[model samples]
Target: MISSCFVTAIQVLILFTLSSPCVRASTFTGSMFEVQISTKLPVKDWVKEAKKDSDPFSLWDPTCFKFVSAIKSVDNQLKEALYTCHSVPGGDENTRLKIYLFIPPERLAPEKQEPCLRAAYKKAFDDWKAGVSANFQIRPEQVQFSCELSV
Candidate 1:
């Protein structure tokens, strides 16, 4: 139990460190909308093909916001994901799930970024588990992912 707790602490620290920039960046902010793919693709093929396509994510996307980063969750049978495709809005050009965030600059709250991010992360894991219970298989570029602010 102690070991598990220690590992959890370490994981939290690492996540906090990596996510701090996204939560603190001044130029952009938005939630990382994750979507799960129903089919499994070879790892290399999946990564190579994800950013090259432009199918829009209509169901999972919250149209009220725009994001700055986009990412895809990796597939592993032992683990499930919460959301697939991490994306950053208002940044450069990255082939995305088609849904965009439209948040206003004036309403930005760099410090309060954790709640949304944490919520997104939690949802991603939940989605992963739900997939299995629902008989949904994982797919390439369709795994869980998150988007943080670009530094």
Candidate 2:
């Protein structure tokens, strides 16, 4: 009888804790970084190709095109990069393209923070270069990439 009562009390306490409004879930701020892709081609040329058809993400791989398009529509800078692409030089003849990406804090798990972020960043970068190479029919190695992280 004592053991039963103890279990019942514990259950009630658990229920009360679970239902408490004062206890809030933890929130995390994800990491944000910019990727710069420098191309010999003009930025205007890239934008023109992107705007050609009903699907503006034609320059991106079909697999990630929709994802990229959704990211593009998230803010006023929607026209930037589909995934936050911006002409860093802000000129017609400039060859610099900057892309912003966020890595959810959950992805930073596995104990090693910096390396995890770098790996994730690299993967996203590889995809971008692949898309760029495909759009221009050039080799992936020819794509110039650099990472920019704001302090």
Candidate 3:
């Protein structure tokens, strides 16, 4: 009887262990910087730049196109979009953007977190670089970006 009880206990423990959620370290990308769009420029111009012939609007996700559409509806002198992408080991952030693509944290494997985050930062940097380049005519390479990670 005791042996049977012990086996049941061990089985229960194994099941519990398997069912438990595993939490891992999370890192935030693009947390240290913000993309500022000049209000002086027309929103249509920005859309046009983003939707250049080489990069058609259709190439972007439908949600991204929606984001750009939403931007068109808003009227502000200076628009700022905070680009913060976090990689949570077992979870995801559902937020999306037209300019900066937010990569969910769950898509990245444990070993590939850093590289994936670096890629995300590069995307954010490139988006900002392109925006300023179109608006202010500044060199894309000259734009600066600083990324930060938080537990």
Q: What TM-score, computed on C-alpha atoms, does each candidate reach?
A: 0.24, 0.40, 0.27
RMSD of 2: 18.0
Residue runs of model 3 more than 4 Å from their true location after superposition: 1-30, 34-114, 147-151
Question: Mind giving the per-residue lDDT tens digits that candidate 3 earns over 40-133?
Answer: 2233555555565353442333333433444334443113443322211212222212222233333222344466554664454455456645
Q: Which TM-score value belongs to model 1? A: 0.24
- The number of clashing residue pairs in each candidate reads 28, 2, 1
lDDT values, one for every candidate: 0.30, 0.41, 0.34
Clashes of 3: 1
lDDT of 1 by residue, 1-151 (tens): 0111111101111122232455432222322233323343233444444445453332223221112121223243213222222322433323233222333222233443456654563454454445432432333334433333322
lDDT of candidate 3 vs native?
Answer: 0.34
Q: List the candidates ranked by lDDT, beginning with the highest.
A: 2, 3, 1
The per-residue C-alpha lDDT of model 3 at residue 66 equals: 34
The collision pairs in model 2 are 80-85, 81-85
- Tell me, by TM-score, which candidate is best: 2
Residue-wise lDDT of candidate 2 within 1-151, one digit each (tens)? Answer: 1111111101111111233467554322333233333344543454565567565345542323433543433333323423233344434432454443334333433343466554654565566567666665556776655434321
* Candidate 1 residue runs with Cα over 4 Å from true position: 1-98, 101-110, 113-121, 128-136, 139-142
lDDT for predicted candidate 2 compared with the true structure = 0.41
